[model samples]
Target: MPGSSILVTTDKESVARRMESLHVFRLKLLSEEMCWLILSQKAFTGRSQASREILEDIGRKIANKRQGLPLAAKTSGVLLQDKQGREEWQNVLNNVIWK
Candidate 1:
């Protein structure tokens, strides 16, 4: 919920199909900052949290790797939610397949 509260899911292929078919939803690529905010909210909020400030250090790398996709950011946050420490974060960061 960064730029617009409305959520839509589409990549290149899905967008093309949407255009040709129903065209009900519009697809927009999120900004890196927006993705970062999303990941921050996901990983560091409510019942589960470690040091929330750690989000700042690894955030840029994480957001960049997500390619401004909210789904990607959310998925990544889920992957990391129960983990702790720089080692875990760095593992996610260094893994090319994580992208």
Candidate 2:
């Protein structure tokens, strides 16, 4: 195919080595602050009834559990979108997946 491009995202170096004519770009993990920001943005996009202080506090804990991964933070944020209670967010933060 002419003028066609494919983007592959992977953590494996060997996969890139096996490919030809590829432009490989590595993505570093997000910082804790950035993770929290991303999570908060996605989680609180349309809600206003929740307490900002409590949400921010829980959001930080959830962000830390993301391990600096943007996808993780984004996914967690999306998961939290429908949850409006502190206990709900805390439950997500304490999930076994983060362990």
- What's model 1's overall lDDT? 0.73
User: Model 1 over residues 1-99: C-alpha lDDT tens digits?
Assistant: 576544345566666575565445556879988888888777666533447665557856887789878899998877777667777888888997964
Q: Tell me the deviation in Å of residue 55 in model 2.
A: 1.9
Give lDDT per model, in order: 0.73, 0.85
Task: Give RMSD (Å) of candidate 1 vs. truth.
Answer: 7.1
Candidate No. with top lDDT:
2
Instruction: Kindly report which residue stretches of model 1 are placed more than 4 angstroms away from their true locations once superposed.
Output: 1-9, 14-20, 24-26, 46-50
For all predicted structures, in order, the TM-scores are: 0.71, 0.84
What TM-score does candidate 1 get on C-alpha atoms? 0.71
Clashes of each: 0, 0
Error of 2 at 78 (Å): 1.0
